[model samples]
Target: MLNYRNALRVGTASCLEETSVDVSYEDGSPDDDDVPRRAIVAVLPPDQETRILMLTTYLNLARCASHVGRNKDAVVCATLAAGIAQHDEHTDHLITAKILRSRAHLAQNHLKQALRDSAAATELAPSDHKSVQLLARDVERAKRAALRANKQLAKEVSTWVQSAQSKFAEQGGNEADCAQQ
Candidate 1:
């Protein structure tokens, strides 16, 4: 039986295994952010190099899965991306993680969940950018759509309740007893 940390270590190792062959020098540096893809991939330990590639690869693959209506696959990819990104705890990585999670929910047909996450990401970002604002507005639209859907569901439920009440009344048509009912 492995502990939680060791289990995660194993998971991260599996993710990094793919990139190990290419990254000849693994220094386990936290300050590797200057090297673009290399930097992101190098954040993990030497043994976990493949896991980094797996994480990034899944992030890219999630979008394609969404297009093909493979929602379960999309969700799996996006979730992996978010989890890996969040592991780093860097601000940019957190933003990426939030977006990945949001997109995964969206792909799974959970627009409300996506909107909530997008809103959270917008608030989490420090600066005002056009893309951030756009995401925020998209979240608003998702909220409206979810509200409308809820209202429709409520109406249907109300109708069913009324129908059931009428049926009960018709069956128990005795004056005093029915009135009490």
Candidate 2:
């Protein structure tokens, strides 16, 4: 399994390193700032000589995957990149990886996990860094999404409760009896 996973990572990194593609957001809205305008590929030489190069490759692959809506793959790649960066104590790369994973989680509507990652990224970056600014935007977006989801869930539950109450009332059951049931 380790060998297969490594092979997959190396293969994907090779392709991403060799490729340069324009990236647009999944939605037409302008607020899609999670991904770069162009895929961040091949910042280092293709030699893949150092840990930083590997980290870049993984980050680029994850970004491309997220751009293309392969969010699950993006999450895996970003998590791997985050692990590498954390191990190497590379704050910038770790921040990028966390933001990418947060984006993937947001895309999948895992709002709680998304919020956690975005917050973590925000905390990791220096206050004046561009990454922190970007993370601020993402954290706001995630909060809004969570709020909307919570409102929707409350509405649904309220509707269900109302329907149940109406049915019980029609069947001549009092609120107290229904509560006991």
Candidate 3:
């Protein structure tokens, strides 16, 4: 009884839901950064290929954004994670996405956004849980640091702008003078 579009959507959704991740930490420390989630996802059945792929893809994209200092790229990865959760329904992925989304917000100094996402991740996370709890704590700490960072940058930029305005005023609002000094 499903319409063509609805069927396609459902099928695609299920297809994507098959993907997953590895969440194990070695001695409470991640053994590898490249595919930190590998250990967790690897334990799942071979039939869950999509879940594995999605998890890896999201993690890689997030790492890439960090390496490149690209907040937009990070946001895109987070968005993909949010989408994956629609069909995946696994608690882990949802928590991971929330953490990733929080990272994106933190990178851009969006404190409120970061706080909300990180808090969600921490709350929904399992007790005696895996990766989610640690990431949530990390993000929460980072959120506080980000707030300070934003305020510091705002102060610096404001000071610079104010100094420039004062210097320009001394020169009778001369554009050329402002540009020179």
Candidate 4:
């Protein structure tokens, strides 16, 4: 079993090399090809370390996707990372995944979802991690800004509707007539 695991790791490494894909967290230039990394993670044994590694890979993929302006793919990868972390009861990975997912949501303008994920991350993160705390705070500010924008939009729409209604009334058209049309 140990030999098989080693062989699998070696094979995955070779495949990654062949694909020239770097799914490292610190890698500024990530490869566009994520299939090899995904395949390796899919075949990893259901062990604690392997699970953590898989979550890490997913997180990296999410980051890469976001960097490439693929917000939808980033959200998908982050969601996968979060799910795996939750299933494996890996608190650190869970926090990391939540943070990543929150950022993805923010990028996609999913303010509510971003707020929720950021709140979860803040709750799960340790007090020592000041960076995560700051991220959570930033997310909170973004959520507020989104809420304000929505409110402003609603007010604008209401005003426009009222103006249209007044114009229709001037043209001898009632609400019922407008509804029928």
Candidate 5:
């Protein structure tokens, strides 16, 4: 018979494994169903160790969400993980959460928020840590990419709106009414 602590760990790990397998089978696109919700519930045990495990699970879920273009969900999971890590005084998890959140923000074209999160992650990480340095570099790159993408998106949207207004005006419609429509 497993001890209570060990059982909790095993259960949490099992839940993580199940979710990862399910995510892999979906080719990086998470289902808009109950799998992630169930995983979150499964990992929420009351013990400290289990709480740490829950933090890990949340981080993993955030990564999965980011992978599948669910940037909003990724931000929510990463923020929850960061909050839990802060409450538990887990610096490593906190740093990971910040990094993940930064990436999610970048994916969502929130460049400023991504840069802020990257700065927080750098401040939280030890100066001598090589891995954290790499993470910071990656975040910087993502920020730059997001800036360029945002500029292009803005230009495209401007062109689209102009075209729409011209077409509406040619059809005897007012530009203001076309915008509302």
Candidate 6:
């Protein structure tokens, strides 16, 4: 049988397999944010109660990080908490982790990822939970923010394309005149 430390190591390794963003949009590299994967829970033991306590700590850390505008840090903390709270007995912690993660993603403007986490939390929590209602409102705010960002990006792209086309036409006209001469 594996030693307790070895089992904890293996468990931590397995938990790192989860994707950073569940609903990816354009192709992109994995988020190698500053938070080291193992460092987040390196001292975790195999005990269930300790794990639950650590989950609470991480969730609190995530909330504080988000409040300070450190969204990437918040995401990392919440993700680690979620990984630790995977057992049936830790359902409430898992829900809190998902909600915190969703908020972090929303702060970072990752609309799809935020929605995915929010949905997971909603599914896990009772329909009448106060946090679930708050999450619904957060989702609405995220949708509006995403729409505004999309509109801004579209305008920027259109302007860039127009400028590029005009420059190309100017170069083509100059080349034609040079050929005639």
**Could you say which candidate leads in lDDT?**
5
Clashing pairs in 1: 15-50, 15-51, 16-48, 16-49, 16-50, 16-51, 17-50, 17-51, 18-50
Candidate 5 to truth, TM: 0.53
Which stretches of model 2 miss by more than 4 angstroms? 1-48
Candidate 3 per-residue C-alpha lDDT over 1-181 given as tens digits, one digit per residue, 9 for 90 to 100: 0012111111211111223322233124332222222122122223567655876687678768866888777866665555455345666776777777777787787778777887787788867566666666777688678778889999999899889878888878875667686
Q: 23, model 1: CA deviation in Å? A: 26
Scored against the true structure, residue 78 in model 4 reaches a CA lDDT of: 79
Model 1: lDDT to the true structure: 0.57
Q: Candidate 6: count the clashes.
A: 0
Tens-digit per-residue lDDT, 1-181, candidate 1? 0012122111222234333312222223222112222223223434456656766787778768777777767765665565556554445654665666676676566887787768767877876756567666766776787799999999999898678777777896544554575
Q: Which residue pairs clash in candidate 6? A: none
lDDT of each residue in 96-177, candidate 4, tens digit only: 8788878888888888888888888888888878858877878878878878998999999999988988899899999888
Q: Which residue runs does candidate 6 get wrong by more than 4 Å?
A: 1-43, 152-181
Best by TM-score: 2
Give the per-residue lDDT of model 2 (tens digit) for 1-181. 0112132111122222233323332223232122321334223233435767778888999999999999998988887687667656789899999989998988898877787888898889888878667766876877887789889999999999989988998999988888899
Candidate 2: Cα lDDT at 73: 89
TM-score: the better of candidates 1 and 4: 4
Query: What's each prediction's clash count?
Result: 9, 0, 12, 0, 0, 0
Error of 3 at 173 (Å): 27
Give the per-residue lDDT of model 5 (tens digit) for 1-181.
0112111111222233433422221123232222342334233355898888888999999999999999989987887788678667899998999888988887776778888888898899989867568767877787677679889999999999899899999999998898688
Task: Looking at model 2, report the run of 10 residues with the lowest lDDT sum.
Answer: 1-10
Models 1 onward score TM values of 0.56, 0.64, 0.47, 0.63, 0.53, 0.62
Query: Pairing residues by index, what is the TM-score of model 3?
Result: 0.47
Report the lDDT of model 2 for residue 21: 26
Ranking by TM-score: 2, 4, 6, 1, 5, 3
Candidate 4 Cα misplacement greater than 4 A, ranges = 1-44, 172-181
